[model samples]
Target chain A: MKLRALAHSRTGDKGNTSNISVIAFDPANYERLRREVTAERVKTYFAGIVKGDVVRYELPKVSALNFVMTETLGGGVTRSLALDMHGKSLSSALLDLDIPEGEE
Target chain B: MKTIRIGSGAGYSGDRIEPAVELAEKGEIDYLVFECLAERTIALAQQAKMKNPNAGFDPLLEPRMRAVLATCKAKGIKIVTNMGAANPLAGARKTAEIAKSLGLTGLKIAAVGGDDVIEAIRETPWPLVESGGSTTDLGNRIVSANAYVGTASLVEALASGADVVITGRAADPALFMAPLIHEFGWAMDDWDKLGKGTVVGHMLECAGQVTGGYFADPGVKDVENLARLGFPIGEVSEDGTLIVTKVPGSGGKVTAQTAKEQLLYELHDPKNYFQPDVVADFSEVEIEEIGPDRVRVTGGTGHPKTATLKVSVGYVDSYIGEGQISYAGPGAVARGKLALEIVKERLALMQVKTTELRFDLIGVDALHGPRLSAASEPYEVRARVTGRTDTLAEAVRIGNEVETLYTNGPAGGGGAFKSAREIVAVQSVLLPRDKVAGTVQIVEA
Candidate 1:
């Protein structure tokens, strides 16, 4: 199953860094997100697009995970020549992450 | 609990004016805030000021004031904004003129200045946060340097009985937080309250975003009436409790889902979201839907602020040249690829010197690149070629190469568009809190 089935995400950019938040639709699914969505996996998930390290911060109270990816945005909004300069669509791309079916 | 209602009018400079007018006329709010400055907006405004001294503020400031001033005044709703981009004094004067022209008297407009620290930056070089270089490296290329001043001067402006407060380069949350401090008499050193207030400000700073404006996902997360999406109003109490909602019968819904999405938007570390006022902690913040369109927020706290304030330094980075053309019908994907190849070859043939270049198919790989794009090809695709160059002449040739594809390369290509523009990039540095002073000047109508 895709992560989109259990969660939603939004992307925000500052300088060359991009912060993406993934929130669980059901609070019960938050633990599943925390267990499956590791920083190493996320960094690999965005292999070509994100050039630097990815750090994930868990918001347990809110049932969300904030991933701060550095050296993204193609050099920041003001200087990036990319069509989606702010990397706004990157959140939608992360929703395509595959989550394992069934319980662990 | 003595609660105050504050409406978020405009999120950015180009945000919709009608929603703000709606807030002023019928939102039944006491204070209305418009967070209009982006990272690079002030830098562009500085450029505009160089051309015309009186024209550094938000261009829509006049129209926005003209639309909401009378209504806001009639309802006794105080207006606060960073629409004063690079020049708040000029912004205040213009607002005063508009108020006087509208026959509204006894209106006090205050402008907070002293955020401009370019002179100080010139005097003593600060280490750049992103580039790991000193301010001296940029030298003459630097266009503007404005420190992110906090809520002190804004609180002072409100306390002076000013109906409207304008500032340049203020922290976005400070615009919303200042009112809470002034209305509730929250001490400047109250870290916990300031943190909660920062949460409220962060939620309301983007206006309609906390509503259903940006959270719509077809079939998955459905949002209704987005066309008439109403901006948010924070019902805040003295002790820093907040309920995020919208005007009754207005567009968009306020639920825990929307609140949670906004809570983490643009946030890096949830444990320490830094602001000029306080280092807020949203780690334990709670969101619950108390009513149909109200989400109660609590559990926000903060620590004392850092010794230094972040300053945004804007400089001429480079020039960007871009061109796009659409290809449709049977072999659109192949033709689009051919178009990109031709432009790449043409740029090389023309000896175009570019630091960076990109060839993208709009529908297929424009956003996520080819790795993540779908395997199947689309019937229609727009080929885009973009490059960054030191000189404007070199930048212009990148687009010229793409435009030639209409006649020289692709078949059935249409809608060729090209543009060349200078890039004003922003970097940050930290200035000691004591080095920057904020002062407010009031203008009466």
Candidate 2:
């Protein structure tokens, strides 16, 4: 199952860095999100677009995982020649991440 | 239970004006805060100021004030905004003039200054946070440098009995935080309260975003009546607790999902979301939907602020040339690819110099590259060619190549559009908090 089945995401950019937060649709899916969505996997998933390190911060109370990826936007919004300057669509792109189905 | 109801009027500089007017007339709020001014907005405003001294503020400032001022004044709802952009004094003066013209008397408009620190930045060498270079390297290219100021000056403006407060480059959340501080008498050192207030500000800063404007995903995360989406209003008590809601009978639903998505918008480290007032922590924030279109938010705390403040430095980066032409019917994808190839070869043959270039199919691979795009091809696609160049002449050539496709290269290519503009890039640097001062000047009508 895709991550979209269990969670939703939003992307925010500052300079060259982009932070994307993936929140579970149901509170019960929080543990699976934490276990499956690792920073290493996220960095590899956005290999071409993101050029720097990825840091993951967990917000258990909100059942969300925040991934901060550096050098994500071509440069920054102002300098980047990309069509989506703010990388706003990246959040939707991240929702396409595949999450293995677990026992219900 | 002394509580103040604050309405978030406008989210960004170009946000809708009617939503704000709705808040002013019907929201029943004490304060209406407009959190305008993005990272690059002030830098662009600076360029505007260079062209004309009196025209650096938000262009919609006049229209927005004209729309809501009389009603806000009648209801005794004070207005706060960073629409001052690059010139708060000019903004304040203009607001005073508007108020008087509207026959509203005894209104005090305060302009908060000291956010502009280009001269102070030039006096010393400050290291750039993004790119590993110093401010000295930017030299003459530096157009504007403004620090993310805290709630102090804004609070001061409110405390002085100002009816409207305007600023240029303040921290977005601080606009909402200032009223909380002034009304509740929350000390500047009260980190926990400031943190909780910051959460409210962050939630409300985006206006319609918290109310379901950006959360609509059609069938999956469906939001109703987005076209008439209402802005948010925060009901706050003296103890820093807040209930986020919208005016009754307004468009857009304020469910837990919408509030949750907004809570993480533009936030990196939930535990250390830095602001001028404090380092707010939202990791433990609880979002519970107490009633229809109402969410109770609590459990946000904060740590002491850092010694230095983040300054956004804007400079002339380069010129960008973008062109798009749509192709439809059968074999549109193939034709679009051919057009890109033709433009690529044409630019090379013409010896056009560009630092970066991209060929994208708008409906398909424009957003995410081809790697992530769907395998199946669409019946119609818009081909876009964009390039960044040092010179405007070189930049213009990129779009010219794409426009040439209408006649020279591809078949059925229509809606050819092109634009060439200079890019003003923004970077960050840290300066000692003491180096930048905050000042408030009041203008009365």
* Candidate 2 accuracy as lDDT: 0.92
Superpose all Cα atoms of candidate 2 onto the true structure and report the RMSD in Å to 1 decimal.
1.0
Report each candidate's C-alpha RMSD, comma-separated, in the order given.
0.9, 1.0
Per-candidate total of colliding backbone pairs: 0, 0
Q: Residue B423 of model 2: what lDDT?
A: 91
Instruction: For residues B31-89, write the lDDT of model 2, one tens digit per residue.
Output: 99998899999999999999999988999899999999999999999999999999999
Q: What is the lDDT of residue B339 in candidate 1?
A: 95
DockQ (0 to 1) for model 2: 0.83
* lDDT (C-alpha) at residue B199 in model 2: 95
Show where candidate 1 strays beyond 4 Å.
none
lDDT tens per residue, model 1, B10-87: 889999998888888888899999999999999999999999999999999999999999999999999999999999
Fraction of the true interface contacts (Cα pairs closer than 8 Å across chains) found in each model? 0.94, 0.83
User: What lDDT tens digits, residue by residue, belong to model 1 across residues A1-55?
Assistant: 9999999988888999999999999999999999999999999999988898999
